[model samples]
Target: MGKKLLVLGASGNTGQHLVKQALERDHHVTALVRDPAKIEIKHDKLSVEKCDVFNKEEMRPHLENAEVVLSCLGFPLQRKEPVPYYLQVAQVLSETMHEFGKRRVVFMHSWYTHPESRARCRGFFLKNFFLPYVIGQSLNGMRLSEEYLDSTDHLDYTCIQPAHLLDGPVTDKKFILNETDSCIADAAQEINRADVARYMLDVIDDESSYRKIRAIGVGVDVTDKAILTDDNHSYVPNCPIRISRADVARYMLDVIDDEGSYRKIRAMGIEGDDSYMAVIMEQIDEFKKVIFRN
Candidate 1:
């Protein structure tokens, strides 16, 4: 049974994965973008619509046709606006969905939105400076959007929050999920955008996930050598610094692929650079030993 979904921000990094994966699963997707030309894929099941997402009238027709709404909207880092680009879209979507009696909606948010999660950052630089300086406006917008969603009791909404996003293909390992505010994986700071999309679709219709905030990260364990320290001068142990965008897509699909994952945040990632380097060193050492022994 393929459901009809309306995806906002379909041209974005994560949005692209959502649109593609939904088609792979046989779901009919109406990708709403400012520029339909940005969508490169042409599929019978996928319809690209060009429209202003901030206008309720413009979104009404699409909202009426959708069984689920997935928003992967993001703001550019360099944008100097005090508010995020997606805040208005969020408002419009919420209003339109309610007017049309649509209940299922899922939003893509960052783990930084959680105060407790932000406080958990390993060092002074990341906690006190870097994150705030770089993405503070985007964070504020997401937080405000979440707050707006929370005020509405009629919409069955789930906000998928992931750690730092990475770009890459899906990995062999599964992503981890947590229902709480904090990510369950130790020192896990990044996830694939694809996995985030996968998780959103997976729980789109699950009743348990409705009105819940889920935090996700990649499942790969970070060993000691790979852990990096921040300005606080403390080693952040077992941290996989990033995950691939493809893996994020895979995790999102896996969640949709399985019913049990409903209402849980799925963390997706691969091994960090330091961990990979360590493995390479071990291999070289083994090769040296073999040559000397011979």
Candidate 2:
């Protein structure tokens, strides 16, 4: 049987995939978005609600029947206002869920939010320059949110951290899972938003992943894929480490009822497999055709 799911940030890049994929798997989903029009799909099992996540009163009614809460909340690249937005959302969700006796929660975070990630940043360019200057505020908010979640004992929370996000298609490649002090190589610094969503859903009910932070990236080598550089594929960047958003959604739905993923931080990266890259390229090529209308 499909679980009742309450999805926060349902209009964002990843949330859209999550909502669509969940419905495809027969799960009843209540998607909370700031703008209802942004959700293009209409299904009887899907409920689109327009409400601020920080508003507990507005969110209380939605929590009544939800078996699980999935947060795909994100901030703009240069957003500085609402100083600690992620933390505030975490607090609101925690309070509301506790009030309604809901226990399972999954959050989408970043690899940079992990404590060991600082060392993985390596050199001055990333550690000193990029992180602090390029995405400083957003990173700070994620870190704070992570810390707050870590301190909470009542909520069964799992934070899935993905490295640089890509808008690629799902390759169905097997992911390599790791935890604690695993350094994601430069080649593995990217994963499709879809795959991250997959990991989040997979571990949803798994007790092994509860209260844990999982970091993910794609580590495949696609040096020989010619389709990546083809002229018709301008949007799909010529990169080897590609995973799709659709696949991510597929993964999440697969594990929403499993018990091994609860309270665990499972950091994931794609295994180095050339065959997988070949298949991924084919999907990307097809995806490109659809985008270019060729």
Top TM-score: which candidate number? 1
Q: Best lDDT goes to which candidate?
A: 1
Q: Candidate 1 residues 55-135, lDDT tens each?
A: 888889999999999998886552244356656777788888888888898988887675566777764545665555556
TM of each candidate vs. truth: 0.73, 0.72
**Candidate 2, residues 1-294: lDDT per residue as tens digits?**
889999998898888878887887788999999899999999999999889888889989988788999999987554333238889999998998898898899988777765456766854455765565556557778878878888988889987777767777655756655556333653366778777777767787799888876666666554322332222433233243444444444445655886765654443223334444564555455444433442
Q: For each candidate, C-alpha RMSD in Å? A: 14.2, 13.6
In terms of lDDT, the poorest run of 10 residues in model 1 is 224-233
